[model samples]
Target: MNRQESEAHVLREATADDVHLMLSWRNQETNRHVSKTSHEITAEEHARWWSAVRDDPSRRVLMYVREDLPCGVVTFFDLRLESPRSGAWGFYLDAEGLDGRGETLPAWLGVMREAVEYAFDGLHLDRLDGEVLGHNTVVRQMNRRFRFVEGTPRQELSDGREITVIPISLARTDRRQR
Candidate 1:
């Protein structure tokens, strides 16, 4: 993608209309394989989750817009709106859709860039944090490229199996240095 094309990608607050689309993306095999909770989420369960967080002040659900089309979702939760503003974030792309158009890689990189901008600029956060499965080296490397410091990995039981989870954080000072 060219500079203009990359700049064209942005994010908007997700609305009710995008719920099912987000669920579909989250349930994709590739997404599920890497997620802490890999079970397929039922529509009812998804609805419940949406209901709980839709109007929450501490959480933000954003839709990734590429050329005016929504192709992915980014979510910020565990938000602390006080002096030291911070939050945890996660995202999933419309892999099938973007892959068909040969835009998957660009979208992946673009979304991370936009999300970081949103956290530090739009949200005026002091820090942003996230977690990655230990086995997901690509994401770990990508997070590092964004200047996120990886914390020590910890083990967790999920889906009846033990998995290593790596925590990562980026302070505003570190991001500004980038």
Candidate 2:
């Protein structure tokens, strides 16, 4: 599909069947290298983790689907339903399905737009925070496009190597201005 057509993608709550696919995507080399923890996850670990968050009221795990195919996963955690209405979120797209097919940019843009809308409009969140590995310039730029302002940077270990992670946040008002 073309960029415009791909923009019609949807994000739905992830189901039990998605656990394997999501785990595979999360364990991909590129995804691991850019994540906070780079260790490969075993099926048992994934199952345990999935079971913990699957029914957590403070978390939302969603799958991005386009043309009836899964393209990515988006997750929101640490949801504070009280005053601030803030949360932390992260996402990753299927490289083989989207990027390898030369639809990376558009697919990412569409999924991210939907994710942001879901955060603000559906969840009524006042702000959404994200942390990106310093080396992931593409995602940092994408965050800018979505009006995510960069915050403080911190050091963390990924794959046994020290790496920087920069925090970014998007406020409801900021998104409205966009």
Candidate 3:
């Protein structure tokens, strides 16, 4: 299923059973556009990563479910609890027939809103930030809509062409509106 099929999607905690399925989706070209992957991940690698991921209290990986079908993933890392309450995040959708431009963008916005709220409220983090590819207009638009201020132009993760690193931050004042 794709974005069209994810209208009634549910965001749930990821599990050991969903590793391979998540890998298949993450490998899609649309997803790989901004993802860091040179090759497919091995099952063994996934297991090891999942083990470490599950054991890390500062991280969270959630699965987006559509009509009981798993369709996407979103993960947050590098959580710090002291003066800065924030974490970094990344994700991609796997619903096969859905349009990234039409359906996935909106879905991602809602998920991102919730994720930010969780970071500030539940985790008591003061900020949340992330980097998006300069070529990925759809994602950039979403981040802008979510009040993620654009940062300086940087070649931080560019595959070849210079990619601007866009950062989104959420502060306590920002959360008060929600």
TM-score leader: 1
By summed lDDT, which 10 consecutive residues of candidate 2 come out lowest?
A: 1-10
Instruction: Pick out the ten consecutive residues of candidate 3 with the lowest summed lDDT.
Output: 157-166
Mark the regions of model 2 whose C-alpha exceeds 4 Å error after superposition.
1-7, 176-178
| Per-residue lDDT of candidate 2, residues 1-178 (tens digit) | 4566745688999999999999999888878877898899999999998999999999999999886789899999999988789999999888766767898887788788889989998899999998998899989988998899999899986668999999999999998432
Tell me, by lDDT, which candidate is best.
1
By TM-score: ranked, best first = 1, 2, 3
- Quote the lDDT for 110 in model 1: 86
What's the TM for model 3?
0.78
Stretches of candidate 1 off by over 4 Å are 1-7, 176-178
Question: What TM-score, over all chains together, does every model reach?
Answer: 0.94, 0.92, 0.78
The list of candidate 3 runs beyond 4 A from truth reads 1-10, 95-97, 100-103, 157-164, 175-178
Taking every candidate in turn, the Cα RMSD to the unseen true structure, in Å, is 1.8, 2.5, 4.6
lDDT of 3 by residue, 90-166 (tens): 77877454564356655665567556666676677777777777778877787767677667656664344445566
As for lDDT, the candidate ahead, 1 or 3, is 1
